[model samples]
Target: MKKTIFLFAILLFISCKKEETKNESLYPEAEKSAEEKQLELGQAIFEGKGNCFSCHKPDQKIIGPSIQEIAVMYKEKNGDMVAFLKGKAEPIVDPSQYEVMKTNFAITKNLPEEELKALEAYFYSFAK
Candidate 1:
């Protein structure tokens, strides 16, 4: 009887651990889905209301540095690009053209926090 109970308890503990592991795996998938959704929203805003494409391109410089360039610069600084968007942080990528960006910040600074975060995610996605 003692042997049987010990075996049963060990089996129960193993099963509970397996379930916990399964739950841990699920969390990242859900988080990835949310991040993807945010990226989609950011892309829409960049191409639409943000008017970002007017001055910036994905891989090459236009009136401003490329999106990839901005991503690399921000990642290097470990910077808060969202705060930069909100006009709370200074430009780290291209201070020489900050005057041009200042006009654009007038629009970006007004964006809601969710949109700003989404935009930052979208920009970071360009980094290599």
Candidate 2:
């Protein structure tokens, strides 16, 4: 009985290892490019701590402008999103919404530069 249990345990461990290897090959996390990683970081911030999804959505406008609109306008104007997030530049998409957005600056302005850049990259990902 002891030998049988040991064998089953060994088989289970081996199977788990094989499954992990297969999943790793399929996902290939290490193969992700810098831009992909940046996008992911930005997405996380947008959906998570940034609470951006509460206002700015990916497509249509919600409380503020849509992500696509912001991206398109920024690209056309060559605006620096990072600067705007950092509270250095003024809002260009919807100045009327600045007061509402200003309340979030306390959260955004405190974020690290890398995180801010990642947010910009994420936003631009929706650009046409």
Candidate 3:
């Protein structure tokens, strides 16, 4: 009887531990702050539909300037990032690459206002 009880106790502990871990992993998005959620959405767009990752990286230059560089350049311009994404503003970080970016504007210019804001917020978050 004692051995059975010990085994049951061990099983219960294992079950509870598994449940705890499962819950932690299951609802990670629910636990994220608003900024985190925005960043996640922005990242998804950047990597998925926006296709910005093809030419712009978070920290390094590729075919275009890095996200960090754009963020810093626009941080003082007040809404210029959103304007650029919306095709309302000209490229300021690297005008030499503007043609490449302009060709991609069709993809970004039509984004929903909320997504544009979120993408801007995400880029600005990287500014230093």
Candidate 4:
């Protein structure tokens, strides 16, 4: 029984390892889309009126975190990122870091819904 269990575990490890290596090669066209063009508009809001560039960049971390990291957290949380923006959902990634963002959300609270949608799309587009 012990030997069988060890063999099963080894097989599982190898299967999971193979999956990890194949992940990036699985998609190509989705990386660039008309939806991504909208991100350019969203990116402007993020950097300008939203002033998100003060804390975030496309690939780096600042006082908060990167947009890429947010995209990963959004996928893992299994919920709409917009709901989180509306205060309808709790933080699932780096909640300690969220506390810092908490100080700023009130400013974001007044943003128009369309703008919020654009922002959500903008952040998620990084996942592409």
Candidate 5:
């Protein structure tokens, strides 16, 4: 009887642990902070609908400045990237690329405010 009770207790402990793990997996977003969620949204926009990845790479300059470069510049200068995307602010990262980026304004200008902020957060994510 003693051995049977010990085994039952062990089994109960294992089941509880499994249940906790399952819950953590099921609601993964619940564990993410607001900033993390914003970054994810920004990444989706940059890679998908925003089409930013075509010109800007994460670490190296392609058709435009790298994300890290932009983030560092903006952080240092206190520039407003979201305002630029909205066409309310001048280009601060690469004025030479302004003409090229203008072509994308039609898409960026139409994004929801939340998405624009998310994109800004994503860019700033690379700031060191």
Candidate 6:
């Protein structure tokens, strides 16, 4: 009976984890001033420090979707991209591509709010 109870608890935990992962990319909200600055910083980080541009880009897909495409999806979902940087959000948009992104998962699994926000801004900036 204890074994059965433990299994049930594990399933419950997995279910909750999936839900939390789905919403990982969202931010609380953003002010215009902060967003602009974050975006600029994000661009530098993504292209330079993050090295995301190798697999991803502002307007075209490399190994991953373009930043503009990501922005469009984020806008539609009304979700937070920040969660993604923290390894929270799942690859719902492109499950097949998850394998390609999996390698970078460890690096982005834990990021500061500022860095994630800046990355979001950088990605969203390409939508225009």
TM-score of each: 0.74, 0.79, 0.74, 0.65, 0.80, 0.66
In angstroms, the error of model 5 at 38 is 0.7
**Model 1 worst lDDT run, 10 consecutive residues:** 26-35
Best by lDDT: 2
Provide the RMSD of all predictions against the true structure, rounded to 1 decimal: 9.0, 10.7, 8.4, 9.5, 7.5, 16.7
lDDT of 2 by residue, 1-128 (tens): 99999999999999999988777786688868899999999999999999999999899999999999999999999999999988899899999889998888899999999999999999999997
What does candidate 4's lDDT look like per residue over 1-128, in tens digits?
A: 99999999999999999878666665744555667657776787898887888988777888778898888778776657667777767887678777777765775677878778888889888875
Instruction: State how far residue 124 of model 1 sits from its true place (Å).
Output: 0.5
Error of 2 at 128 (Å): 1.6
User: Is candidate 1 or 5 superior in TM-score?
Assistant: 5
Cα lDDT of model 3 by residue, 21-64, tens digit = 86778678776789888988898898999988999899999898
Question: Among all windows of ten consecutive residues in candidate 4, which has the lowest summed lDDT?
Answer: 23-32
Q: Tens digits of per-residue lDDT for model 5 on 1-128?
A: 99999999999999999989877786788878898899999999999999999999999999999999999999999999889999999999889879998998999999999999999999999998
lDDT of 6: 0.77
lDDT of each: 0.91, 0.94, 0.86, 0.78, 0.94, 0.77
Better of 2 and 6 by lDDT: 2
52: Cα error in model 4, Å: 1.0
- Ten-residue stretch with the least lDDT total in model 2: 22-31
lDDT pick, better of 4 and 5 = 5
The local lDDT score (0 to 100) that residue 67 gets in candidate 6 is 79
Cα-based RMSD of candidate 4: 9.5
Q: What lDDT score is found at residue 75 in candidate 4?
A: 73
Per-candidate clashes come to 0, 0, 0, 0, 0, 5
Clash-forming residue pairs, model 5: none
RMSD of 6: 16.7
- lDDT per residue (tens digit) for residues 72-107 in model 6: 887878767778667788765567888778777566
